[model samples]
Target chain A: MNDTLMTDESRLRREHHKGHYDRETVYRILDENPFCHLAFVQQGQPVVIPTMQWRVGDMVYWHGSSKSRIAHGSDSAKVCLTASRIDGLVLARSAFEHTVNFESVVVIGEAQRFEDTAQKTALLESFFDHLFPGRWDALRAMTASELKATAVMGLPLHSASAKIRRGPPNEPEEDRATPVWGGVLPIAMQFGKPLPDEFNQMPEPGYLARLRTKP
Target chain B: MNDTLMTDESRLRREHHKGHYDRETVYRILDENPFCHLAFVQQGQPVVIPTMQWRVGDMVYWHGSSKSRIAHGSDSAKVCLTASRIDGLVLARSAFEHTVNFESVVVIGEAQRFEDTAQKTALLESFFDHLFPGRWDALRAMTASELKATAVMGLPLHSASAKIRRGPPNEPEEDRATPVWGGVLPIAMQFGKPLPDEFNQMPEPGYLARLRTKP
Candidate 1:
């Protein structure tokens, strides 16, 4: 992997200090977040859609109904995929200095539809495995029509960047002495007790029982 | 206040039943999520920016560095703003039926720069108040250059929609009897312990000490 990735177009244009293009940082944030907002231009205007997305190595993939115009619009198009997780709320002394601690990644690439059913099935299984380990094998195999209705597009993570922020708020020397509470309030994703399906009559998989994400 | 909002441009083309155009649902989702992905066409290709944004009434606001090109790009142009909160992970009996329960809002409109100093100042304070309540007044005031360096843009929510999914996974009868565990793992965002600044010498505010999001 390259030390950094900065194309004429991928370079961070604002707050450059907070910008990072390292492949490791980019890949880590991508893998950690399963949801991403896909941005693509249509008829001179841009649209954003939150969808299920995953990354394998450097290639990113998204799935949707092939019959849907909006979801299928991503097939062979210039798109920007972005995923972000808010780490904490950075409470600076001054309102102007207040910011959020976050890790974000952006990948700009052209995505093409995967016409090969075998490849889509394999990727779909991976998606299940990633989200629900030790359970994919037990589920029934997918039907051809199910595969036909789904559209999977792959975008190589060629041009990407990650912006990460951590630690306490950046309070200037003068404001530090002020009698105001200033610090970082950590925000985390916690999984609660699982609610079984109405007809589910089987024992919980060990992995599903341990599906909680450590905040 | 009406029953539903359906615009030729803003309507959900797929999963039509999941689409909601009611102003109440749209407003509620907007107020609940402070972070939004702003999508707009930048030189033909779309760019998705993870930004701090909030909606007040029908107006949506975003903050950024005024000097930067991408941040300033929203001065006056068509844009799509989207915010989403994941409610739970739907573990389904079938791998193909897996989904995430979430609530998302999308608004399509044109964004204009808030150039007036007074208006910008008020909005900036609102940002702080929304993120950290009972703390804005304790901080020091901003200088003119600080105000000049920041960019605030407002977009009116003219055409919008909210997509919400809740409850457990949609398991059909045939898949329900299978001997595989399937359920809904509720996900939540919780605020962790506050990490004080190195120089902070004041007691934490009531809001910060008991920081929690009611999921």
Candidate 2:
């Protein structure tokens, strides 16, 4: 595999030192974050929709209602899919130097709809397994009609790049001696206690234990 | 104020019940979330960039490097700004019924740049006060050159809609008897303990106490 996945559109113009084109860096960001914002041109106007996304090998997939405008507009259309995670808030002595520590990946490609029912079913199963291993087999099987009502689309990672910022704030040389309190306040997404549905009769499964231990 | 702010493009087609066009609901979502994704068309290609956003009255503002591609492409151009927060993960007996509990606001409008220095300065100060009250004054003043290097843009909330989903998953009646464990896993963004810079000699400010007590 190539060391970098750089394309004309994926190149970073500003703060170029933070730009990363390695597959490992890009895939790591995609895998760590389950949510993404998908951008596509609709009716000659730009539209963006937030959706849950997962990766399978070199392709990233997201599902939506078959009848959704997102499904119709993105089918076989060029798109920009971005996954971002805010790691922390960097506070400097000066507001000008204050910034957020984050990891983000931008992938540009043409979205391809998966029309094969069997393939779609397997992919959906993997989505569940990716988030919660062993939970998919424990649940009821997906109905044929249910599969037909969902649209699954995938975008290859051919043109992908990652941008990351981390650590303490970068203070200006002259302001380094300022007495102002400055540092990093970490930000994280955490899972609270799981509340069982009112109708649920089963005890919590083992797969859910991971959520409690996850950082 | 009008009861709703619905335009042809802002109306939701599928799951119309989840759509909210009222200003109160729309404004609440924008105010609660500090980050947003801005989408715009650049040379006929759709592009999405994640940035920090703040809402002041009927307008939402974001800043970026003046020389960045996002600034150049979105200047006086139609753009879509979306602020989303995932409340929880809804789990159902069947994968088909799985969904996320979230509050999202999508605002479509032309991004207008703020060229006046005084106006930009006030807006930038408000941005800090909105996120961390009284912290702006504690920090060093922003330099003239720094202000010139940044671009501040605002979009009116004229064409805005909020979509919210909450509570347990809606499972089919027939599948209610399934023995699979199902429920909602709550998700929240939290602030960790503040880590002061290595060179800092000042104690933490009172403004940071709010972060510790905030939910």
Measured against the true two-chain complex, the DockQ scores of the candidates, in the order shown, are 0.77, 0.77
Which parts of model 2 have CA positions greater than 4 angstroms off? Answer: A74-76, B1-3, B74-76
lDDT of 1 by residue, B90-118 (tens): 88877668788999998887778888999
DockQ of 1: 0.77
User: What does fnat come to for each candidate?
Assistant: 0.81, 0.78
Q: Candidate 1 has what TM-score?
A: 0.95
- Residues B21-67, candidate 2, lDDT per residue (tens digit)? 99989988898898889898776667888898999988999998999
lDDT of 1 by residue, A1-215 (tens): 55676776789876789898888888888888887898877666678888877888778888888886534554238888999888888888777788888888888877778979999998887777777776778888888988998888878877888888888887668888878887888888778888887777877677756667443
Highest TM-score model number: 2
- Write model 2 residue lDDT over A54-152, tens digit each, in one string: 999889999999998767854238888999999888989898899999999988878888989999999999899888887788778888888889999
Worst 10 residues of 2 chain A by lDDT: A69-78
- Model 1 ranges off by over 4 Å: A1-3, A74-76, A213-215, B1-4, B74-76, B209-213
Interface RMSD for candidate 2 relative to the native interface:
1.3
Which candidate gets the maximum lDDT versus the true structure?
Answer: 2
